[model samples]
Target: DVEKELEVQIGMKQEMELAMQMLEKDICDKQDVLVTFRQQLDDVQSLNHELSQKVQGSDNVIRQKNEIIARLEEKASQMNCTIKQLEQRLRQTQSSCQSAEEANYLFKQEFGEKILRLQNEVDLLTKQRSQLEMGLKDKKLSLHSDPHRINGSEQVKADQQQMADMKKELEQLREENLRLRQAGEESPSNGIHQSSRSSAEAEKERSTLERQNVICKLCEEEVSVTRLKRRCHNCQAIFCSQCAINELPLPSSIQPVCVCNPCHRVLLQQYSTTPPP
Candidate 1:
């Protein structure tokens, strides 16, 4: 019986050895699978890093494009403002040129009228001078023919006085003619410069000179000087009171500030068409 028990124990030992061998083989297969999984995980991590770098580069390119667009928009706006300013300046220049042309035309018309009026006055004066000369010749002939009948007669004395007064008037008229000729011969630039004086300043100077008994510029006749008399605001020349009343009449609104016919015409033209400031 003891022999039989020993045989059974030996058989059990052999079965246990076989089971241990099978467990060792299964453990070796599982280790191989774990190594393959670890390699795959490392590859995935490398790919993810490369993708992140590409995304950052794309973001930088987009940011640069946005900045360039903003700069182009700002430059366009500046160019628009500059173009508008240039257009406005061009319009202003055109307006100024038109105004200057109108002023030049008016000045020419006024100058032509003045020349015509002066010519007429000269012709009238010449006719009057000739008539006076003929009257003096007739008077001289009568005086020589009746020498004895002159000194004692009142009519003879009156005739002599009248002759002296006429001679003096003729001399005065000649002087006035010479002066007019000189004034007409002056340069246009000089005349323009003289005319540019402010009217208010001219009036002030004229008033101050009136107190000093200023001579009449046209007729050369001495008279009481006042603002009521005819005066040229341009040349600041006083005219004889008798001539002023007959020849140059002042506007009611501009009373006591009488301008000559030439000056009055200029003022009328300047005020009529000039645009309001």
Candidate 2:
């Protein structure tokens, strides 16, 4: 009986040991599941943070695009205004040109005979001037090659006197050209006269636009625009008014326009050579 009791106690002890072992294995399994759940939660939080950063970056790009759009709209508005102003000026210029053309036709009809006679004289003078220039050049080259030619001093004096005479003739022609144009310019043609006056004033004002110091091509004088420098209509060269004092009619316009003296001279020669219409 004591041995039976001992066996039963031993069986009970073995059953308790088995139950303890099962409980420990179950606890380990529960711990592993909890650790897996914690890892999943951390991964979800990281993904949410990444999505927030991407959203903020997208907002910045959208804002920049809006600013660019506003600037473009403003620039387009300014350009439209500029185009409108240019169109207005074009219309005014066309109207002024038409009035000048009518006046020019009247002047041509009135002075046709006188102009022909004057033009014939101009032709004779220009031919003489050309011959004189050629002769002077030939003499200069000869003197340079052979220093022993007749005293350069005497020859030079005669040449200078001849040049002076030619210069006088040229000046007369220049004066005649100006007088002819002025007659047309001063004609009491309503819009034409006013347009000519305004054009001259505008030319003077426009010439003063350059801010930086510029040297006059003819005089080589440093000029501050407000006082003197002007552009020649014929040559498109800048010079002091003193050097470009002559006024002549441009081929395209009937009104007398400012031109450099050299250009005025050349223009006279060319006009003299051309046959009258």
Candidate 3:
């Protein structure tokens, strides 16, 4: 009985030792799991810090972009204002140009009417002078034919006084003609300065005048009929058919063109000398 009791006690001691070993193994496994959990927690905290920094950098970039957009918008507003101002100035300039054109047209019409009236007066005066000259010649012939008649002697003295008066009137007419010519020359220059702002505009006005058939340069008469007027090829001067002195050959044209006396003289002087063969 004692031996059996001792074996039972030994078996009980072995069971206690096995239970302790199992408890220690369970504790070590639980510590390893805690260590792994701690490492995972540290990794998660580092990832969170990196994400916050990235978020802050993105916010800073967005703010800078917003500032640039605001500045660009301000610049756009200024440019629009400048564009409006330029448009207004352009409109004003156009208005001024139109007004200048109207004034120039009126000035040209008035000047043309004055020239036509003056030309008519000059033609009438010339006709009257020719009639008076013929009358004086007839009176002189009658005086020579009838020398002894008392009435004829008195008539001859009266005709001599009339001739002296006509001479004075002719001198006055010549002076008036010179004054009118000088005025005509100065008028165009004054009109150009007052009305034209650009060379292109002045050229356009001159072309318009040429197309309108204003006057003959030689006769100072209005050139209303195309058939009666001729233009010189060399000098581009307009003259009446009666005033044209000759026809000249031009390299560019097939037909001969009429020329004024001055241009014909110039051409003769230029080509009269024979070339060396």
Best TM-score among the predictions, by candidate number: 3
Arranged by lDDT with the best first, the candidates are 2, 3, 1
True-structure Cα RMSD, model 1: 14.3
| Greater-lDDT candidate between 1 and 3 | 3
Cα lDDT for residue 81, model 1? 93
Give per-residue CA lDDT, model 1, range 189-248, as digits (tens). Answer: 122221234789868865665556556665565657332345664556676443332222
TM-score, cand. 3 vs. native: 0.42
Q: Give the count of colliding residue pairs in each prediction.
A: 0, 0, 0
Q: lDDT of all predictions, in order shown?
A: 0.55, 0.71, 0.62
What would the TM-scores of all predictions be? 0.31, 0.41, 0.42
At residue 194, give the lDDT of candidate 3: 26
User: What ranges in model 2 sit over 4 Å off?
Assistant: 1-27, 113-181, 187-277
Clashing pairs in 1: none
Give per-residue CA lDDT, model 3, range 123-174, as digits (tens).
4554565566678688778878887777876776786677677667756654
Model 3 stretches astray by more than 4 angstroms: 1-19, 115-277
